[model samples]
Target: MALTPLSWCVGAALALVCGSSWPKMHSALAPENEVPLRPTTWLPEGKITSVTLPKGKTRRLYFTLKKASAMSVTISPCDLPIEWSLAARTLKDKPLKSLHWTTKKSMPEVWWRGPGTEEKIHSFTGDAVNTFSGPSHPRTSIYILRLRSKQQSTRATVYLHEGPGPSGTFPLLPADSNVHTLGVGMTSVTLSWAPSPSTTSLHNAENSYNYCVLVNSLQNYPSLCAAKVSMRKEKDQKQDKKERRVTVWPILKEWWWQQWDTYPEDQSPSASLEDEYDDLQCVCDGTDSVCTVSELLPDTQYYFDVFVIDRLNGTNAAYKGTFARTHEEARPAITSLREGELRWVTFGDLRSNSEQFFSFRPRGWQQSGLLTLQSCGGGDKVKVTVSSKGQVLTSQGVGGDLVHIWLQGSPSYLIHLEREGSTTGQISSVKDQALPGALMASVKMQISSAYHRRGVPSLPSTLQIKSFNRLRGCSSVTLAWMGTEERSLYCVYRRKLEKLEAEGVSTLTAPCLGPESRSDTERVLCKYFQELNPRRAVTTAVIGGLEPGRAYVFDVYLMRRWGIPIKYASKMVKTRKEC
Candidate 1:
């Protein structure tokens, strides 16, 4: 016969056991003797079935346990006394624990004794219960379900269910090794490491993983910490807080600003997201084992570390940290020259349309100054414009060399040169003729002002402080100056702006009183001084070890041969806060 409907068998069994007339068998029924049973045949969880039972016959079914720790089976509405048993065996056919049950007053419920406490089994008339509980054992195991009846022909339905498997935790993987710096530069470093041993295993167990390279400052700069600021994504917020902790310093703002100095293109009002992303320091692929970190400060020491993060498990492991230092900045070359008694200052391969600025203070009875430009090569013609304090001087369509003389007026001037096409060349002062090789394009100037007689004492031209650049988060400042005189000594002095102001002294006038003639306040605060070489027409000084977040006044003095002060210049600047 074909298999019977389990619902029909259950209903019929209930009526027969209750003393009512036997119900008709389901149209589709299969004899117990004919039902297929095998040692490897396993029913899916929550499966139910019904079959006709021949007198004194038995049938068995099999299932494999994986991750699951226990198994349960139930039989209900049986017309005859039927017995059911469940047994477990290892993959090698070794027998484990076994259980048996028979029909009772109510439906029977049975479960394995594993992971959880034993549950009370409830039974009713015309029902059978069978359950097997035990350790799932190592690896995999097979389970067998056996059913039999001793009385006359009857049918019963069997229902099977399995408990969930145990939950697993992330495994501890080996950390990365052989971490080293591949390359270093003034503002960037490349790093590499051996593939993490646990990488492959993690990939097999999880969907994905990523490598995170961290850099910290080894020096006094607090902003250089390894766990400091970095490019982050919104999705990272979901990660555990411990995995996201990073050390940061307020001065980092200046460091980052210096790293990515504003470019002309970026400064435009119409910038886009794509542009911003492209301008980011460095973007390494998540899957890459090596990465480059950029936007770093020059001449700085930093500690680097590499770590792996399991995306699926949200855990991180770090490699050993390494140290690296960036190279120092290169200085520009300078050539000195003289025209009669006046010294001419010059330098550069000034590009077309690019402007150069210089500050100068003429003597008390100064008259005029001469500006000269000579093309080294490239373009055929050039246009040079010199402007100062509302006064303008333009020389256009000139080839080879050009000269423009003007009466001294303002204390500063801006020079701009342009060419017709995309040609490159250099321009320098007429006095540079003494130099042999082709001169790099440059602009030179010599002021023809009134001067003191032979042995007479007189002050040098006023000192001119040109530019001041403060390094972010550090106690350092780079100062550039012009209007330096030959045969004269130059001294740079700096002091706290607050102290200078409190003493009712100004850097411009204080130095004129001679170093010893100053009051205790002026002498105490302005004690830091450095003598610059007189040969340098244009000079740049890097002053470090200043107090952060404080303002200071700087003075540059031009001293005569007799040790008498001539002229002095001053400027004020503030240093970045913490870094």
Candidate 2:
């Protein structure tokens, strides 16, 4: 039943006369609560509070419970249609972004549907009864009752009455503060925040503090508690069925493989779907305020919410805002070190605790090479890691006056140099490797390799045209090639020969045209197409829809891994007059 203003006053008088004492629910009413809920407007147990909700504004108020009970909120005799919801508040001032409510910056009092409550809207025109279970004792559980005015300002008397229910106690946790990004790398993000402030000391069962850092790729934040946010399993069966059908056609299958190979693995379709829900990787169980989330996609925005979780009681609270973006993958500077050639690379403007990449292609390495590092009076602040084909071969710190890493094999290698220490800020985590203090350092890198006089070839193996047949159609032909280089790509270029021209373009003398060639009778292959088949070292390509009876010059070039395409083989084939 709804309580009127006169009836609520009479009830307050009775409670005052009986000398009944209730815990003060409204302890702190700062910007966290958003609404102008003062300490005087607190709703005592079994009493009604009158509040005037202004036009186009939301009014929020919270009440406390001393024991486990069924609670309900009743709003009566209002002029305009008001939208209101009763949500169990956990982690005061922490806003849980929901699809149901409009989340404002100042209004940290967003609605979070607890497990015991069936999230519903109550208004004066419809059903006003709401019942939910909440635990009490050890500490009071605060529930936020928000009333939103739609049409105009209206005065309403809100009554919050609790009844008897099963007795229990809920864990009381405080919200974290200053949640922000400390630093970001290609695949990692470092976060720093302050611990929650609580007066009551936690017991043995509620002693463990597992600070869960929920990361979401979307703009919205995750839920405060793990129970509130339900993570769903990804459904990939339908996608697998579609991929099987696409593989039946050879052309489509080849195109799909080419696209997949070129696409970054971090930004794939499956990667986006997997990040829709929250994961448990970023949980900082200890009291450390710094956490580095690793294995994330580069050049992407990620939202973070810190939850103070009590493992025993399953209670949690969300921290404030945490939004940071990872940086894009930096392209390494390529440097070709010839035999007996000494190159001195210096890093003068490198930032603290930041990484820089350098690609070193050593030619004619008859034996292992030597990489020496020298610190420029800053006592070895740089660490060097040498890797080949995405595999780390060795990593060492150049803390001493001299450091050397013996490079083995003649394959192309990569050198990752990272500077340590922070010139500013409290502290930062690099892949969870913490470095303290505000220090700056520089190092000079020198690389030299021994080799034979003969130049070691870094080019792809031979590519020979096997056959070019025009029997398929007058405008189409099947071209096949053989190559020894595995995972080699090819770009096909075609040029039509003039009919009246007496000079026949041979495979040797014919000019290998790029996509930009143009003439009256001779036309270039307009489409910038490249074929890749990782399943085989050699393959066949079917070229169709061409001008019949005209001789065409075709050139095939093997594309290098990081360089321009080199001319491998060429063939001149005339299309048949008819099929």
Candidate 3:
């Protein structure tokens, strides 16, 4: 059970009224008759001591100092379950300051009683250190130290040390120094540190000191500590008109990281060296124990070090360095797509009535295609239509930003955009295409257009090839296209125009054949064939395994169920010399 705040206050008052020594009846219940003082050589004149308390009991100790000054005290538990309080007071019973702490187990009995019998238990076990300065006194002065517990019987130990006076020399090195990263991001990191011994153990004005922080990239740059700033001077003209003086300003510490441009020109280092020390070093207030460093690159590792500096003496003590890595940004799946290859065409922008076409040459065992419209901008009411072989497959108004259209097999397409009216103005479209079980093509485009007087087409228009890119160092190229119908058949043909002209091969026309028919002249022109079902508005294809450094012309023809004139789109590409 826990005591209420009012009840706890009452208990503390009663303990104080009981005096420094317990009565015989209460003493008899305690395991120890008196508190013990442990001898130690760590303190020059003070002593280490301890006291044991039983349930609901308290103990008090008195100290007489030879001189008046500030003193440091550390109180720690002896691995026993208990709650304790420490208080300071003058011999006349004038209260000074007090601190309360506990070592209670975190988990309750219910945590270990259930099915999780093997669960680990946790508890609070830590120590506290404090410093207090007393009023100056010529004669010996008396002080009081009190310890109390309300729960299980336990022992508490205390360590006392004389702190440095106002004029004492600073420590040669820092103690109890710690550094750690508080937070990390792609371009910035926050850091925190505990106050050094020299800062906490001595007495001085708050603005008398400053701290220096150094940051360096461990993976690349070597030294980031090159820039330096000169101190400014303050002078009293009335005292000495002929004399000159200078004084360095105390550095200011901020709660968050600051950029170099935010620093004052007079207080900052040389501007010529700004880039050299942009994120390398910073000077902060001595009282500030936390700061942030920014302007870091993503996916990079960096090291940081902190030093306690005494501005008056220009003396500094360095703490150990800490390291952290920034996170990397996500990347696309495929960076490049070769021409004459079957690939999903995804991610491009198109304008109203702007015809986009692509030629796809299917390889062995390749089938199926997908077209997706991810988003559109300009807030205009827009509709997109896809067609092939003069047949409209899909023509629907976009209700939201995202739209998906699937094609059963590889087929060339002609995609067109149509807005409600000319007032709809310029719009941007983002679309992508993909093949089943294959990599997607990178085809991002930004389309800007003014509505034209040409009315929206009532039927599917002819296929148009939008763009063609040859894969570097490979005998392949990628093609992007639009406008196709659902459940339509298409064929891809590639011919070396230069080679054919050089060999004097005449153009031959062959009659259309059935689905399973193969003619010698048809084989000469037809490189690949595919049938599209449940059609899409956009398509992209890759053609590979051709002779390197050779120029080839590609033609995509939409096939119909009955014999009809071939409606086709074509593009020419040159393969790279290297594989």
Per-residue error (Å), model 2, residue 520: 43
- Model 3 regions more than 4 Å off: 1-174, 201-205, 218-283, 335-424, 427-579
- Residue 474 in model 3: lDDT: 61
lDDT of all predictions: 0.46, 0.49, 0.43
Minimal lDDT window, size 10, model 3: 223-232
Q: How high is each candidate's TM-score?
A: 0.29, 0.27, 0.28
- lDDT tens string, model 2, 398-427? 642346566767577788878764344332
RMSD of each: 26.8, 28.8, 24.7
Q: lDDT at 192 for candidate 1?
A: 82
Ranking 2 against 3 by lDDT, winner: 2
Model 1, 551: alpha-carbon shift in Å? 71
Best of the candidates, lDDT: 2
Q: Give the candidate order by descending lDDT.
A: 2, 1, 3
Query: What tens digits encode model 3's per-residue C-alpha lDDT throughout 1-579?
Result: 999999999999998788557543333221222222322111222433545657676554444445646555544444343443333322222111221012112111111121221211112233222223334333322333455556566555555556544323232334546578999998888888877766665577234445666655522111111111101112333345553222111222221112212234355322332333235354456567787887777898877766665543322345556889987765323222222222322322343222334322222233333333422233344455766656777887643223445433334444554444322454233221112222121222111111221222111244565545534336677765544433344556566657664344432211121123233333223333332431455555676667787776666555433222243444566777776
lDDT of candidate 1 at residue 111, scale 0 to 100: 19
Per-prediction tally of clashes: 22, 0, 39
